[model samples]
Target: MTSPLANPLNRRLLGASALALVLSASGQAFAQTTPQTDETDDATTQLSLGKIVVSAGVEKIATDTPQAVTVLNQDDIDDTQASTIGDLLDDVPGVYTAGGASNLGQTFNIRGMTSNRGEVLMLVDGVENYFEGYRMGAFFSEPELYKRVEVLRGPSSSTLYGSGALAGVINFTTKDASDFLTGDDRFALRTRFGYESNGDGKLGSIIMATRPTEDVDLLIALNGRTSDDYEDGNGDVVTPSDASANSVLAKARYYIGGDRKHSVWASAQVWESDSYQLYDQITGFTAFGTVRRRTRDEAFAVGYDNSFEGNDLLDLKAQVSVSETLTDQDGIALASSLGYASEYSYSTVQARLENTSKFTLSPDWTAFVTAGLQYYSQERRNPRYKADGSPLSNGATTHPEGDTTRYGGFVQAEILWRDKLVITPGLRIDHTELSPGAGVVVGGGSTAVPEDATNTGYSPKLAVLYNLTDYLNVFGSVAHTERMPILDEVYSRSGTAPVNLNLDPEKSDNYELGASLTLRGLATSSDRLNAKLTAFNNTVENLITSASATSGYFINVGEAKYEGFEVEAEYATRSLFARASYATVDATNETTGVLLNTRPADELNLNLGYVLNSLDLTVGWRGEFVSGITNYNATTGAVSSTVDSYNVHDLYATWRPRSGSLAGMDVRVSVDNVLDDYVKNNLASFAGQGRSFKLSLGKTF
Candidate 1:
């Protein structure tokens, strides 16, 4: 008989078990030795779960919100040391990365919804940000630029976000000068440096914040990243993996008006990446060859906010913004044969105005109502050039140029009946117009004369929450939303196929129910636990099919349904803490009885940490377990293949001196994939990164 310690699998299992047992024993031992009282260490509390969410058109605690949501703050961002945006969000339930593992290749997948299909919406500082291209990710930005990230799951958010939000919304808020200004300090400077061993990656960032006047603050940030090719768990090098990026952020805020209740702000951001990589960023190795690709994203926004303290019916907020995203590719190795060097870009101008009113009806009843109007104009252009740098008379029909303008208005009311019951109702309506760009041509070399299209969409939702007990609560919601057809789907043509001008809007009906449990001093006098379980089912009609080289575009066919459940729990004490998130999602194409390819396998993430208050240090262990998934052909209902399940573990530590000469210094170290497991997610085209040792140092002045 072989010794269990001699087997690699057994070794990993033993490691995991040992870690869990050590954490449990330590926690119990600490509880026994430490003083048992009603008071607990403030630093040991779970702050992530108590975060406030604003993406739902109002401010509510994560546990108090009726819908499913997640919030990651600055501390969480720094601890992850994520290289790509995907890595930063992988721990969230019902959220994962799809496409590839590269910085420019990864995209977000929520439930079974993908950004490529226009199901997901993303925002940076309340400004829309997105780009869609063949085999390319939709949103790209540096993770270091943000101080907070909020994820709102499900289509129920469509009422406030927009009518086409089939998947969910992701909001990123950048750091502000006020965030760094401590006490009466008028200026602050922060610098950070980081390194990763696996890919030999390096990061350098710096920020300067200042209060130039009594009522004005300004901030500027610059960040740069560079990384070389990395090897997989099997010691295979993924080619064309080298990448680099640089970005800048600048913003300012000024307070005006009596009592300083009014304020105005402006911000500008730019992110650019230039790399020589494969044309199809989604796949590492492809026969399409490589190109010199440069991608840039620019955004500018100005806004005004007024609290109107004494006025019950006058709280206003307004904003205007412009954003542009461009991806230019040239020097294509196969351009001579393919006859195309592409330039894809999207330009958008948007404005919004909103107001909130509060009313007190009786001592037990109070209501808050919010209404808003939004307008945006967007243009998508994809131009092609020959190998000699000459413009082509007719561009590729797979991606047609078009303009879209939308006007929308929405109203939502939140009514509270004491602290026991809450009701929320919302409605949104949008009108959109689409027009084809100049020099449009079809696949057969004929000048295409496509007709303009106009459409209207509506979203309605209702949600209720009831506190059955002080320690337990139940919530439920129902929503219906309509998604208008995108330019690519309605205007794209191929082979002998013509433009699809009659594509109907996609409609989604969503239902969600959940419960939460709050427990204090369960095992020890100072321990706390907060847990939530959510179950959701969504049905989408008029699912659009993508066009092929020989097929026309935007054909609305059958229905697609998705059902899932999520569990989020946190436990903490003075010296020990544990957090876990588990998700199970299943989706199918009702028309063909085939599982949706975008569906991810059930996953569970566990994290446990121990704090050494005397040393100002915290150490933690994390384990991620994913289940196997079976793939099937959409049309034929044939088994394609299966992805095997895998488990990966990580170890991390952080130290920040509070009362010493190094008080302003912060240090972090992490060992990712401690076992070097060859992990593969169902939505990914490549295996996950191999074992890596990461370290970072930051200091404030």
Candidate 2:
């Protein structure tokens, strides 16, 4: 299907159709808000939820995994300028980034997996975390309310999760009462003022509080940010500056009796927002913005877990959520006769239960067994009709509305030997059934195609971790996974379907090895100084893409693979310290022999900190670079070219003075896009943020 960005009436909203040729790859924007620390800094390395308690798959695991996963803790995110997961993802290697501050329908590509037909899968506490539509891009989600981010790179991930995970999985784990389990009542408040280069003004805030009652614990978090349109490096106001979002997260947990051995945990959250697309009202618009392009969303969930006798583990979790999102210019038209239009929405409800046990299987080994089941229901609507009488909704046909039901079960086993070797093998099987589209039957007047497809798939993974020395550990892993097309692909009435659903599900296999090393003993005396590095090759078959066909749908293309390497290291010292990490990814189409159109090949991160007398100072820098790309036409070999390579650098500094009477107060200054790089890093359609600075004061109690 043609992109709304290509529509002449909507062209002004984005740049020119020519740039669309370039930005298809979701680009990454990574900046450093905190400085690196030396090994000496280890003496005071604070261990909190940010450092551990990672939620990667269908369950929570330690950050120390056999795969390439990056854990961004709450404290790090708290101090960073990034307001959402999209902002923080810019620094993670092998991950392509895109969308400005508020591009709801945008998607991210990890490895060589990206397209109008999405391949990436994102989850919030094991839920779909998607817009109403199956083909809808990443649902608009605010990051300030989250506890951490877990990104799994490459296919072969199924061991627990199934399809829609071809390239990777991004799990936005929310904060809970357990995360704030400090001894006393605590509260922290932060507020900031922002100014866009294109000329918009706004304010942002982050608030958190925890209270412990007689037998219960409560935690609360709040964050809000708003801004105006911004100009490019050349002084061009890319879009309207009006953007706003508000979110609240709360959790309550109670202890049984007084032993604290048996406790129950529950949590809930609400997120809502209305934003303006930063673009010319007249030039580029899919639909006019009389009412402004807007969307709304919300979610709620609760669960319980307890540790019992015999080292056995039992857990039960149930959650349900409803979300609605829409984008259109119903009352407002960018072009008079050429006025454009479109609307999309996603709503979902889900729940699941999981159990695991650790028991002695032999004299020399122990075993871990896990089992789980999940259910989901989602509805999507996309109307591509125009303001004036038009024959089609999205360049061709109108999208049908329907809901899909998905259910699945999984089990895994892990065994350890001699306290030096560990092996884990896991499997998951899924069954998905699409609720028939009774609204418009397929083959009706040839305007719509009726498709009710249901299929089952399997996911398996095997990994080995071995301790080679007292200070180092090495590991290797291989896994097979799959990705089933979303409801949008089988039934996108928008006529964007380049191919039809007869296409097979996408599948993948990954091979990798890496190591974790502890170096404080050899380096300058410090409590903890560690480093990790990994390299791998992952290839996918039948990669899905919009194609040219009679039944317009998605289908597997020639083989595509992503080969890359990553290195992330941190050192803390008593007086001063620094930390840095980088990744180089070569995502390419093996059939066409070109770099994956949307992914970058290089990234860099560095941070430094100093503590003197009663004051602490820090300097941080992050740089992201990318090569160019190639776009193709099914009928032709090479159709067009995209953005060239670009690099961005940022700096940040903050001071916390000794506070005897002040209790808790601090000031900070940050310079984003420090060089004012003017390159249009619009991953594909949306514009990018430019050089801007922020200053603020905050307090904690």
Candidate 3:
């Protein structure tokens, strides 16, 4: 069967081609008017024209990185007024979050790759966020706690972030005391209250910062939210959807010396949620029950950063962190006297040390080498029992207790010539070991025991970037990445299914080509345009696939291929802003010659905003479109489900005083799904939220 993207005249193709043409033209025009220079400061000035992303293995501007990346800063976050991380990421091209409106059971998909036993990695403040069971996927947190969010698309990140980052990485950075307090200010406080109509939810938060001394700063924040069951687009209440969540964050920073060249910081966050769960509406599970679910996520980290004052060549950073997640489910059957409970927990401890050394070989040549060592250990435990406080006779665990340890070392070099061309080459070696706990009894009989496995992988990456001009750049990258089979993929079982400890690691070779163009002073004096076009192709060997939804056993699918492209553009002025993004992906199984059912057909986003400067007000409109998709059931071998195309619109307005007595006060109002569209997600499992309204008020002192 022919794929939709195979058609040359497809809108996604045309849009990408048009963007590429514009980039080429802009590059030529800018190149003709400027001459290349060797001053290192000039390169820094050019790259600092936009936000810098530190997660790209180095601190550099997004346009200068040889990969596709998306960054949302504080201003962008405030404009959207989102409550959840999923909501903030909904409009990003090539990104999708499953599970509809609920935060639990949510999964993330990048390009055409979904989570096959943890392919995408999530990080908070550079520490890993781990999950154990297959049913519960990604982590969820309130958006107010984050100061910035960065997403890296593709397997290129595997060189720096091991195993789980085979698809990509998403990092969230929280706020600091210095962000709110001025030089002389000793304390700062901010508070917010919000309400949403669909779920009748209420949100409240308070953030406090204090500087006890010139060398010490502390920050603390608390957020709470509660909501009833929300209605779908058809005005039907989704059962077991009521939820309540609370989160707290604390951080402290201390300067080690008077010069402040050496600094140490500590931070911690705790988030807890209580919700109700029911069998998926489409699953046809006749067993009805009232399930009380609770989840707790905690993270803590300490880090030190130092740039040797006497040694101009060395910069060092070291960090250690621990994170844990626990989930419990308690339920009672409606028709039967049966009752049940289950608990799953996962924890990770990690440490990293890195050093960067710079060298000036000659006037036109300079180089920097970064080397790092990382170590992490993961542990998971799952237990099930009856409501009568007795262990299940079957003794079969949902997810058995397991432990995994990973150690890795990597080095990368960046070499630049005349500040116009840059090349980076890197390599990483990782060793992983997995150990499964004792066997469990099932149906009064012993189940199959799990075996231990150890694996080693070598990843290599090469990237090149050429500056066509200060405002336009073209880049390409090729990487070979490997992912070891996770504990769930290797040891999970159902009934008598044997553990799959013999499974081989999944490996992929990824290639990417892209261009970035920035045009300042386009028409108006304050108008600027930023655009990006990226194309990628990846092939996987020994792809891991689930044998059945009910059975936890997995099998290798031999080989598969994925190809995709994304286009994004944003135009902004002092008072007006507009943005558009589009993406398309194609994935196929080589042996069966069938398309993979992991990705949506296509996605597009459009947003426009205007600022009434005199009145301190801003108004915006946003629209999103997702093409229809078809999904096949691996177990049934049939077209099990289909989802129709959907379009949603949102309108929002915000007012913030810039001066006078109301100076730090803000008020916002927003309406989502203005058309009341009856939209279903690509998975065809849950309907989208109906038309909803939100109002917020905040003040800072």
Maximum-lDDT candidate: 1
Model 1: CA > 4 A from native = 1-44, 257-260, 283-285, 333-340, 442-446, 547-552
Report the C-alpha lDDT of model 3 over 1-701, residue by residue, as the tens digit: 12333343575665766586666656555533332222132122212125678888658767778888888777667666676677777877788776535665456778877643456777788776756443444576778899888888988787777654667888889989988898699999999899989989898999999999989989999999888888887899876667688999999999887887789999999889988765332232336645676888888999999988787578999999998888787774631222277676778899999888888889998888888999989887666677676765321344557788999998888888996988989888989998886553221123545568788887899999998777778999999888888776676666555557677888888999998777655555445566788899988898987663333366677788889888887766677877778888888787776778776668778888888889988899998876777777654447877666777899999999999999989999999999888777674345767899999899989
Query: Of the candidates shown, which would achieve the greatest TM-score relative to the real structure?
Result: 1
Error of 2 at 526 (Å): 1.3
**Ordered list by lDDT, greatest first:** 1, 3, 2
Stretches of candidate 3 exceeding 4 Å from the true structure: 1-10, 17-49, 258-261, 279-290, 332-339, 393-398, 440-448, 494-496, 548-552, 635-637
| Deviation from truth (RMSD, Å), model 3 | 4.3
The local distance difference test score of model 3 is: 0.75
- Would you list the clashing residue pairs of candidate 1? none
Ranking by TM-score: 1, 3, 2
Give residue 28's lDDT in candidate 2 (0 to 100): 16
- Please tell me which model should have the higher TM-score, number 1 or number 3: 1
Per-residue lDDT of candidate 2, residues 293-370 (tens digit):
555666666666555534565533444455444544344354343235555555677777767777787888987777
TM-score of each: 0.92, 0.82, 0.91
Residue 224 C-alpha lDDT in model 1: 97
